[model samples]
Target: MESFFEFRHVYKGFDGRAILHDVSFDVRAGETVCIMGRSGVGKSVTLKLIMGFLKPDSGQIIADGIDVPLLSEAELTQMHKKITMVFQSGALFDSLTVFDNVAFPLREREHENEAEVETVVTGLLSMLDLNDQRGDYPASLSTGMKRAVAIARALAARPKAILYDEPTTMVDPMMSHTIADLIQRVKRQYKLTSIVVTHDTSLARKLADRLIMLHEGGVRFFGTVEEMDASQDPVVREFLQQDELALP
Candidate 1:
């Protein structure tokens, strides 16, 4: 598969401290790559750079054929149509019902056909097991349900690529499994290029075709799960050991 998202020696910083330095990785088309690391290792920053929410001080962030950092505001808007990010917070509009929230992107495209929007929204909601909550507001939903709704909203845009930021954090084990399963279902059904930033080892093992382990603003390991398991690097071993210890 061709590279859908490429980060080449990317650098970004806040204040005088660098959060990412010489970071690089490529997510292939139709492949799922998970970004993993301890807190403040620039895991989420990489996703923002891809979305042009934050600009790198130097280096290239190529999404599809466009160099993300160099795009004009108008150009970035167009690019955003083909790519979407599912934020960790779920970021739903409290005023919009589940149906409307999932339908928001389709409506923004000026479809004019309400029936089409209804069909798409209903299908996504049912697929994500949100059919029962379609009329509910964000305030009423649990954390996992909100994330599922957010994923539904992201898929509603029909993006070529999807970025997920910490999909299973703060949820109970059952809900965490549900979110992971929903993500895997989306991957198999949509065949989208996916980049997931998560610290959950089980989630990573389940969804990642490859894993990028970041540390101290750089990539410490980048390879398949088996390779990661076989890795001799002390950092990788220690991370795995610690994650295992934290599991319930």
Candidate 2:
């Protein structure tokens, strides 16, 4: 499979502190890659770079064959149509109902037909199991529900790739499972190129086709779950051990 996203020797920093140095990885077309690391390891920063929200100090950041950092504002806007990010906060419009929130992307395309918007939004809501809450506002929804609605909105854009930022964070155990399952379903259903940034090992196990573990601003490990489990690296084993200890 061809790469849909690639980062070569990417470096980023904030306030004179380096976050990522010589970071490199690639996500293949129609593949799901999970990025896991401790807090402050630049997991989210990687996503921002891919979205062109931030440019690397040096190195290539490519998404769908386009050099993301080199894209102009108008060019980036067009690129955004093909790739979408589901923010950790859900980022729902405070005043919009669930239906309108999901319909927002389609409406932005200037589709004059309300019926098409209804069809698309309803289908996405149904797929994400948000049909019952479609009339409600974001404030009334639980963290998981809000994330679900955010995903519905992302799907509404008909993006070829979707970047998920901590999808299972701050949600209950059951909701976490539900969210992970939803991500899996979306992957199988849409064959989307996906990049998920999370610290949740369980979520990573459930959703990752390949995993990239970052440590100290670089990739510590990159491989499948089996390979990760067999890794003898103390840092990798320590991270996995810590995750196990945290489980109830």
Stretches of candidate 2 exceeding 4 Å from the true structure? none
- Give per-residue CA lDDT, model 1, range 144-213, as digits (tens): 9999999999999999999999999998899999999999999999999999999999999999999999
Candidate No. with top lDDT: 1
Candidate 2: C-alpha lDDT: 0.94
Q: Residue 18 in model 2: shift from native, Å?
A: 1.0
- In the range 35-109, model 2's lDDT, one tens digit per residue, is 999998999999999999998999999899999999999999999889999999999999999999999989999
Model 2 Cα displacement at 164 (Å)? 0.5
| Pairs clashing within candidate 1 | none
What do the candidate models score in CA lDDT, each in turn?
Answer: 0.95, 0.94
Q: Model 1: C-alpha RMSD to truth?
A: 0.7
User: At residue 21, what lDDT does model 2 achieve?
Assistant: 90
